[model samples]
Target: MAETTLYDRGMATRRSVLGDAHVDNASAKMTEFDADFQQFITEGAWGSVWSRPGLTKRERSMITLALLAALGHDEEVAMHVRATANTGATPDDIKEALLHVAVYAGVPAANRAFKIAREELAKREGNGQ
Candidate 1:
């Protein structure tokens, strides 16, 4: 059997969670400046962390949403919220996580995150996702 490399695992995991369109768009936009950065996130975030066995993708999705919301990473929060469909994380799960973000991170951050999440959810609902 062939040994799967970290980048390979990462690419697969990233594609599964983020979906092909997002990955392909990002790949199409890749350049010498960000090539290494992309590789690093694939290997580190997707391969090392997201591909781990202990947590369900659903659980990880919740945790990721909370962290991104707490950090006020608006775009990342939006992306991960969309990713919830693939991760099996429900709208309620996102609500709970953002509630934690409000308490632990601050109300302002959570408030903004809630708006983004609501918008993303609306888009997904409209698209029949």
Candidate 2:
């Protein structure tokens, strides 16, 4: 068997957290224009950082949610919220993170994130995810 590379490990971690369908859809839409950016996130974000053993994926997921919320990355926040099903971060975990975001990043940023998170949670609950 081939020795696993960073890209391979990243892909596995990405699929585990984000789900195969999302990964496959994103891969299917890949073109030369954004290929390097996609590879960078996989190798750096998923492989280098997320695959590290220091933090549970749940912790990482909450942290990601908080940062994304703080930065007002609404779509990314929603995506990550949906990913919590696999990461073991519950809705309460998301709430706590966003509450932290409110305290640190400001209420407006976290307020918008709360709306997005609630919508995503409802959708996830409906889907039984």
Candidate 3:
């Protein structure tokens, strides 16, 4: 089978997972300062891996949270936790993922992730969005 076009597949998956506003903001921020990095994530992460059908977005989101938490990627972890609302990953799901992270990735990582998740979830809960 022929490979899917990167732009078509990547843009669709990006919008589906990240939401329009977040994607638009990221796009707007992609200037000469980080154009290459932006393109790399769009083509590699969104297009290549996320476009695969092996797992659902919910599954992917959970894995992402765990990996981000493990890697001490606080900013990305916060972003993914916020995205849980759009990705159908409930607060309970995040809790479970952090529990796993605590055991495997270390308690410190999970503890920090929990704080971030709690704050972000609260914001989302208040807005009812």
Candidate 4:
């Protein structure tokens, strides 16, 4: 038997947190133009970083949300917000994280993040989740 590679481990962790459906959708849409970028994120972000033992997925989710929001990565913030379902992050936790973003990263960033987070949460609830 062969030992698992970072890509394999990353795919597993990504699927667990982002869900098979989302991961499948991403995989299906991968083109040559973005294939390398996709692999990099899987092996580097998901495999090496997210798969670490330092923090629970829930804590990582919160930190990810805040950082994404602070950086104005609106789409990623929304995606990670949806990922809260798998990460065990609550709505209140999201709110608190946004508050921290407001204080440290600025109210404008947090304000936009709050709107994005609300939309994502509403979309999830609307889907019968």
Candidate 5:
């Protein structure tokens, strides 16, 4: 497929997984300066890797949560935590992933991640989401 074609597919997948509100917000924030970067992520990260069929979306969600936590990407981690609902990742799944993070990514990171996840999960629960 052409690069633009692939990017369009990627953007669609990205919006479906991350939600249109979040994707629209991010798109609104993109300036001329960061446009390339945004496109890169849409085309590369979402299109190239995330679109692969090797893993279920649920598995991908778990891996994404663990990696984001390990990298201290709290905001992204929180976003993905919210995405758990769409991806069929349960609180139990998140708990198990966080336990893995605690072992490999360190207790501090896991602790902070757990707090963020709890908050997001509670908010979702409150909204009946």
Candidate 6:
């Protein structure tokens, strides 16, 4: 059998975690200028780190949400919040993580994250997720 490449592994992991529609949209919109950047994240972030067995996907999802919130990445925070559907990170789990973020990363960041998460969660529920 042929050895799986990082790109292949990354694509699979990313699609599983983020969902096929989102991945497909991102892939379809890739521009020549950003192609290398996308490939790098696929290989490094999704393939190398996310594929690690040390942490469960749920654990990683919590960490990712906290980090994104702490960094004031509102959009990414929402995106990952949606990803929780596949990662098994519950809304309560996210709330707990954001509580920690409030202490370590500032209340404002955590507050905004909570709002974004709420919006996404509502949408997910509305869709019968």
List pairs with backbone clashes in candidate 1: none
What is the C-alpha lDDT profile of model 2 across 1-129, one tens digit per residue? 888899999999999999999999999999999999999999999999999998999999999999999999998999999999999999999999999999999999999999999998899878876
**Residue 2 in candidate 4 has what lDDT?**
94
Cα deviation at 2, candidate 2, in Å, is 4.3
TM-score of each: 0.99, 0.97, 0.93, 0.96, 0.94, 0.98
lDDT of each structure?
0.97, 0.96, 0.90, 0.96, 0.93, 0.97
Model 1: how far residue 86 lies from native, Å? 0.2
Question: Residues 1-129, candidate 1, lDDT per residue (tens digit)?
Answer: 998999999999999999999999999999999999999999999999999999999999999999999998999999999999999999999999999999999999999999999999999999987
Q: RMSD for all candidates, in order, please.
A: 0.5, 0.9, 2.0, 1.0, 1.8, 0.6
Clashing pairs in 3: none
Which of candidates 1 and 4 is the stronger one according to lDDT? Answer: 1
What is candidate 5's lDDT per residue for 81-123, written digit by digit as tens? 9988878889999999999999998999999999999999999
Which whole-number lDDT from 0 to 100 does residue 80 have in model 3?
Answer: 94
Report the poorest 10 consecutive residues by lDDT, candidate 4.
1-10
In angstroms, the error of model 4 at 59 is: 0.5
List residue ranges in candidate 6 displaced over 4 A. none
lDDT digits (tens) for residues 12-70 of candidate 6:
99999999999999999999999999999999999999998999999999999999999
Structure candidate 6, residue pairs in collision: none
Candidate that beats the other on TM-score, 1 or 2, i.e. the better one: 1
TM-score order, best first, reads 1, 6, 2, 4, 5, 3
Better model by lDDT, 1 or 2? 1
Candidate 1 segments whose C-alpha is farther than 4 A from its true place:
none
Cα displacement (angstroms), candidate 6, residue 34, comes to 0.3
TM-score of 4: 0.96
Off by over 4 Å in 5: 1-4
Q: Positional deviation of 63 in candidate 6, in angstroms?
A: 0.2
Q: 1-129, model 4: which lDDT tens digit per residue? A: 998899999999999899999999999999999999999999999999999998999999999999999999999998999999999999999999999999999999999999999999999999988
